[model samples]
Target: MAATNNQDLESKIATEVGHADVYDEKAAISDFKADAIEAENAEHNMTVLQAVRAYPMASFWAFVMSCTIIMESYDVFLMGNFVALPAFRNKFGVPYPGHKDYIIETKWQQALQVSGQLGALIGVFLAGPLTSRIGYRWATLTGLMLLNIFIFSMYYAESLPVMFVSQLLEGVPWGIFIANAPAYCSEIVPIQLRAPCTQMLQMFWAIGSIIVNGVAYNYNSLDSDIAYKVPIALQWMFPTPLMVLIFLAPESPWWLTRKGRFEDAAKAVERLGRKSAVNSTETVSMMRRVIDMEKSVKKPNHLELFKGTDLRRTLIVCGVYAAQNLTGNLIANQAVYFFQQAGVDNELAFALGLITSALQMVFVMLSWILTTYYGRRDIYLWGSFANFVLLIALGIAGSTGTNNAASLAQASLGLIVSVLFTLGPAPASWVIIGETSAIRLRPLTTGMGRATYYIVEIPCIFLASYMLNPTGGNLGGKCGYVWGGTAFICLAVAWWGLPEMKDRSYREIDIMFKRKIPAREWKKTEIDVNDDE
Candidate 1:
C-alpha cells in the first residue's frame, strides 16, 4: 500500500512536468522531464577517470577539441609582445625616448587590440546559428580556414591600417572557435568528464601563450620585419592539421538528436566508443529522454535564457566570466607592456613574460589535477580571496614610488597574482560556464555569456591601456587599486552567487534549481535520484 501511494505521487509529479507515454512523442518528452532523476543517476554513475579509461576515443577526441582555442591564446600573447618589440613598433608607432624604441599611440594601441575583441564579439554572436545550422565540425572548419587566411594577411601587411584590418578580421575565427569549442566538448563527453574536459581547452590556450612568449623572447631583437612576421606566420601551423582532424571527428550526438536523427545519433555515440560500459542503447535513450524533455519545455532560444530559474544561471555564468576579466586579468594579459612600463628593461620584460606564461601553464595543469578532486565553487572563492589580498599588496607597493625596491615589490606581486589566478579564477571561470547552462541551449547561452563578458571587458581593456601607456594616465603599478576593488566584488559574488556543482549532471542541476536550493547548500544537499516522489 505504501509503495502504491508513492507510485501515485510520482505519477502526479510526472504529469505536472509534462510526462507522456513511451510511444507517443508528447508522452516521451513529458515522461523524461518528469523522471530526470534516473537519467541523472545513470549519467554521473562513473568517475571521470573511469569514464576516460572506458572510452579512450572520447578522451582523445576531447583533447583534439581543446586545441581549437590555441589561436586566441597565440594572438593575445603575440600581440602583447609585439607592442613591446622595437622592430615592429618602429614600423607603425611614434618614437619615444624614455621607452624602449616606440610606443604605438595610446589611441591606436587601444583600437588595434579592441578591434580583435570587437570582431570576436561579433563572431560569438554568429557562432550560435552557424553551429546550429551547419553542425559543429563544419562550423569549426570554417573558422579555422578563415583564421589561417587572416594570419597570412597580417604577416604580409606593410602599414598600420592594413594590420589593424587584419587583426579585426582575425578575431572572427577566434570568436567562433571559442564559442563552439566548449559546447562541443560538453556535448560529446559523459557528465563526469565534462568540466575537466572543457578546462583542458584553457590548458591548450596556456600552451599556445607559452609558445608565443618563447618565440617573441628569442626573435624580438631581429633586425628586419621578419622578426614580427615570423611569429605571425607560426600561427599557420595549427589550423591545417586541426582541419584534417575535425574532418575525421564525429558529429555531436546531441546535435543529431536536435535534428531528430535518432539513428544517426546512436551511430555517432557508437563511433565515440563501441564497447564502453555506457553502451549505445542506454546512452541514446537517455539523450532522447533529455532532448525531448527540453523540447517540450521550449525551443532553445536566448530569450529563454533569462526566463525564471535560468535567469539565475545566466547571471551567474555571465558574472563569473565577467569577473574573470575584471579580476586583474588584463594586467597579466598585457604583462610585457606593464612590466616595461615599470622600471624593467625590454629583454627582462620578455623573459618575465615567458616565466608568467610557463607558471600559468603549470598552474593550469595543477588546476586539472585539483578540479578532479575539488569542487568548482570552493576553488573559485578561495582564488578570489587570494587575489583580493595580493592586489591590495600590489597597490600598496605601487604607491611607494618607482624606486628599485618598489619596482621589485610590484614585479614580485604581479608574479604571485599570476599563479593564484590560474589556480583559482582563470580555469574556474570556463569550467563554471560550461556546466551552468542547460544542455539544450548550451551553445546559445555559452555564446551569450562570453559575448557579454567581452563587452564588460571593453572598458576594462581601455583602462589598462591608459594606465600602462607613458603618455597617458601612466599610473603603472598604482592601477592595481582599481582592479583590486573589482576583485573584491568578484569575491563576494563567488561567495553568495556561485553554486557548488562539482559532479552534478544537467538533470541534477535542473532538479536543484527547481527546488530553489540555496547556492551554499548545494555542497551538502543529497539529491535522491531514485526517489519515487
Candidate 2:
C-alpha cells in the first residue's frame, strides 16, 4: 500500500493560493461510496463531546487494550526499583566494598536494563509483520498468552542470569502491547477522539508507574523475597482479564477492511459505536475508500515506509518518540535520586518522586485540554521550547555550589520539567505518532516509531549513568545543559519539520501529503476532491 513520491499529485494542484481551491473530478464516487465517506466525515468533524457521546464504546475498547501499557510501566519500574530493595539486593547481590550491606553489581543493573530493551526491540520489529499476518485480535491474544507464561519465569527466577532471561522474555509481549494500543485507538475512534485516546496511553502509563512506585516503596522494607515477587505477581492482574476483554472486544475495522473482510468489518464498526449514530455498512465503505486510495503495487511492504512521502512521515514519527528522551525527560525519571544528589534528604526525595509521578498523570490529562483547543504542532513546539528553557535554567541552578538554595531551585525546576514534559512532548508525541503516521503503513510505521525509544534509550541510559556518577562527570543538575542542548537541536528540527495535524481525517491528511504540501502551510492549504455521484 505504498507508492513513489506522487509527482502527479503535485502537478494536479490547481495553482491555488489557499485551501478553498477545488479540483476537477478525475473520477466520481458513487452515491453509495459518497454517502459512506460523507457519513464518516460528519462523524470525523464532530466536537469531542459530540464524538464521545456518539461512540462511548470506542473509549472503552481503547482503554481495554491500553491497560497492558500500564502493566508495561509497572513492570519497568519494578525492575529498576529492584536494585534498591533490601530483600532483592540480599537475594541477588554480593558484599559491598566498604559495608555489611549487600549490593546488586552495577554490571548486572546495566545488563538487565539493556537486555530488556533488546527483547522489546525484537518484539517491536516483529509486531508489524505478526499483526499484519494474524490481524490485531489474534495477535493480541497471542501476546497475552505469551505474557501469562513469561511471568512464571520472572516470578520464580532465583539468579540474576535467570532473572535477566525472564526480563528479556517479558519485554516481547509488552513491546507488542506498545505497538498495538495507539494504532487500535486511532482506527476505532473518530478523528475528534483519536488524539485524546492515544494521548490517554501516557496517562495509563503514568498510572502504572505511580502504582509500582508505591508498591516498591511499601515492599522494599520486607526482608523476604516477596518484596520483588509480589510486584511481579501484580502483573498477572492484567493479562488474564485482558484476555477476556480481547475476546469480547471487536477487531480493528481497518485491519478487517485490509484483509477484505468487508462484512465482518461492518459488524465490528457496529460493535465499536452506537448503532443509531453509526451506519456500519457505510462506515465500512469509508474504510474501503481510504484503503483503495492508499493501495499500490502489491500489498504494502515495510520498505514502502522509506519511499515517497512516507519517508518524511516515518522520520517525523520516529523523531516524536526519540525526542522524549532527548529533551531531558530522563532527568524526570531520576527525580528522587537527582533530588538527593542536590542535597535533599532521602525521605523528602522519595516523597518528591511520588509527587512527580502523580503530577505526570495529571499533566497527561492536561494534554487532552491542550489538544482539544490547540494543534498538535503547537503543543510540541511550545513543549520543546519550554523544556529547553527549563533545562538551561536547571543547568544554571546546578552551576552554583550545591547549597540548599541552588539545590531547591534545581529540584523545583526538574519537577516542572517532568510534569510539563507529560503535558507537551510525552503525550503530544503519541497524538502525532497516532495521527501523522501513514494509515496503510500504520502498524509498521508505528512499530518502527516506538522502537526509536529503545534505540535512543540505551545510549541515554549509559550517558546519564556516567554524567551522574560521583567519579564521572558529577555534572549533577548541569546534566540539564547537555540534554537542553540536545533539546534545542530537536526543537529546531521539529520547528522546521512538524506539520499541523490538528483534526484532519486520514483521507484529508493522505491527500495533503500526496500533494507535498509545505509543512508550515498545511493549516492554510486545503483541497477538496469532489467525489461526484
Candidate 3:
C-alpha cells in the first residue's frame, strides 16, 4: 500500500507536469529519481579535474559549438574594418567634397548596420522555436548551411542595396548563432566548467575581431576590390567546417531527456564523457530529475519567461546582455572607424584595431582568472564601473581638442576600455546570461536576452554612425559622453540586482529564485546540494 501511494504521488507529479507519457510509466519507474538526485549531488561535488577527466569530449564540443561566434564576430568586425579600406569605399561609397577617399553616406551606413541587426532580431526569435522542434545540433547545422547561401549576396553585390540586403540576410544565421551557441555550451558541460565554456563566446569574439582586423590592416593599401572581397569570401570558410563538425557532435543530453528519449540521453552522456569514469545511465536520470523538477516549477514556454520568478530571471538576463551594448561595445567594435574620425590616419587606426583585438585575447583570459577567484557579480559590477569611469574620461579628453593630442588620448582611452571590458563585464555578461535564466526555459530565455542585445545595439549603432560620420552628427571622440551616461545607468542596475552565482548548481539556483530571495542575498543564502526537494 505504501509503494502504491508513492507511485500515485509520482503519477500526480507527471500528470501535473503534463507528461502523460511519463505518467504512464510511473508505476514501473519507482523512486529512482531520488537516486538520480543523489548521483547528481555527488557529481556536482566532484573536483574540476575529476569532472574534466570524466567529460573531456563534452568540453571540446562545448568549445567547438561556442566558436560559432567566431564567424559572426568576424563578419561584424569585417564590415566595421572594411569601411576604412579605400577599396570598400570605392566599390560601395560615393565621393565627398574635401575628402581624399570616397565615403559611405551616413544614411546608407546606418541602413547597412541596422539591416543586419534587424535580420538578426528576426533570426533570434525564430531560433527558439526552430531549435525546440529540431534540437541543438541540427538547428545549428541548419544555420551554418544558410550562411553559405547568404555569402553570395555580400561578395557579388555591385550596389549598396545588394550589400544592404546581403548584410540583412546574413544576420539571420548570425542571429541564430548568437542565440544558441553559448546556451548550447552551457548545457553540455558540468556546472563546474560552465562559466569558462560559455565564456568562450567572448574569447572567440576577440579572435574573430583579430583575424578580420588583421586582414583589413594588411590589405588596406590594395588598390583593387579584392581587398574587401577577400575578407567577405573568408566568411564562406567558416560554415562548411562547422557543419561537418556539428554533424558529429553529441546532442544536448538535457534536450534529449526533454523529448522522452531517456535511453538516447543516456547514450549521449556516455558519449560526452569517458567510458571508464562516467555512468551514463545514472547521468541521464540525474538530467531527467532536474528537468522534471524544473518542469514542475513552470511551463517551458516563451510566455513563462515573463511570468512569476521567471520574470525576474528574464529581466536579469536581458539587462546583463543589454549592458554590453550601452557600455561602448559599439566604439570598440568600430575602433578603426572611430579612430579615423578622432583625427588618426586610416592605416594607423586599422593598425591600432589589430593591437586592440590581440590585447583583448589576453584580457579575456584574465577575466577567467578573476571569475574563478572573485565571482560573476563583482566582475560585472566592477568592470562596468571601470568602463563608466573611462568613458567619462574619454569624453572629457575629446572635448579638450580635435588635434593629434586629443585624438591620441581618446584612442588610448578607447583601447583601455576595450581591454577592460573584455576582461570583466563582456565575459561576465555571457556567464551570467547562461546561469541566470530558468534552466528549463534557458534556450528561449537566452534567445530573448541576446535579442535584447541587438535591440539595444540597433540605436547605439545608429547614433555611433552619426557620431563618426562627417556627414552626420560628427561627434567623433565626444560620443564618449553619450555612452558614459548609459554605462552608469547599467552599472547602477547591476549593483542593485545582479547576484553572485559562483559554484552554483542549477537545482540550487532554481530553489533560490523560487524562494524569491533578494539578489544580494544569493551569497548569504545556503542551498543544500544534496536536498532532493
CA lDDT scores, all candidates in order: 0.81, 0.81, 0.86
Considering only N, C-alpha and C atoms within 3 Å, which residue pairs clash in candidate 3? Answer: none
**What CA root-mean-square deviation does each model show from the true structure?**
6.6, 8.9, 5.5
Best by TM-score: 3
Using alpha carbons, what is the TM-score of model 1?
0.91
Off by over 4 Å in 3: 1-31, 296-299, 530-533
Which tens-of-lDDT digit does each residue in 1-533 have in candidate 1?
A: 99999999999988865643433876655565554544456567777767786667777788897898888888877777788887888888897777557779888787777777887898988888788788889999999899978887888888888888898899888888888888888788887777678788878878888999899889877867887988989999899999999999998888898888878987888778647455665676666665654664455677888988878888987888789788888887888888887778778888998898899888888887677678788888888888988988988988999898898788878877876798878887878888888767777887888898779877887888998888789887888898899999889878998898888766567778767899999999887754321
lDDT of candidate 2 over 1-533, digit per residue (tens):
12434665564553452333332232244665676667667775788998898889989999888787886777766665676566887888878765455866656756665667777888888899988888777778888999999999989998899988988898898789888888888899888888888888999888987987787667756889788889989889888999998989998999999888999998988888898888887788778887888886667678988998999899988988899889998776666656766777655666777788899999999899898679788988998899999999999999998788998998899899988999988888888888887768988998998899889987886677567644346688898889999999999999898999887777778888888888899988765644311
- State model 2's lDDT: 0.81
Between candidates 2 and 3, the lDDT winner: 3
Maximum-lDDT candidate:
3
| Residue-by-residue lDDT tens digits, candidate 3, 1-533 | 99999999999987787776667578435556655766677676877778888889998998889889998789778878867778988878899999988998888888877778888898889888888778899889989999899999889988889888999899998888898887788888887778788888999999999999999998999989889889999888789998999999989988898888988888888888888987777777777777767775433678989988989999999999898899998988888998888888888898899999999999988887788667899988889988999999999988998877999998999888888899899998888888888667877988899899899999888888988899998888788899999999999999999988888777778888888889899998988755544
Candidates ranked, most accurate by lDDT first = 3, 2, 1
Kindly state the number of residue pairs that clash in model 2: 2
- Candidate 2: regions farther than 4 A off: 1-29, 93-103, 529-533
Please count the clashing residue pairs in each candidate, in the order shown. 6, 2, 0
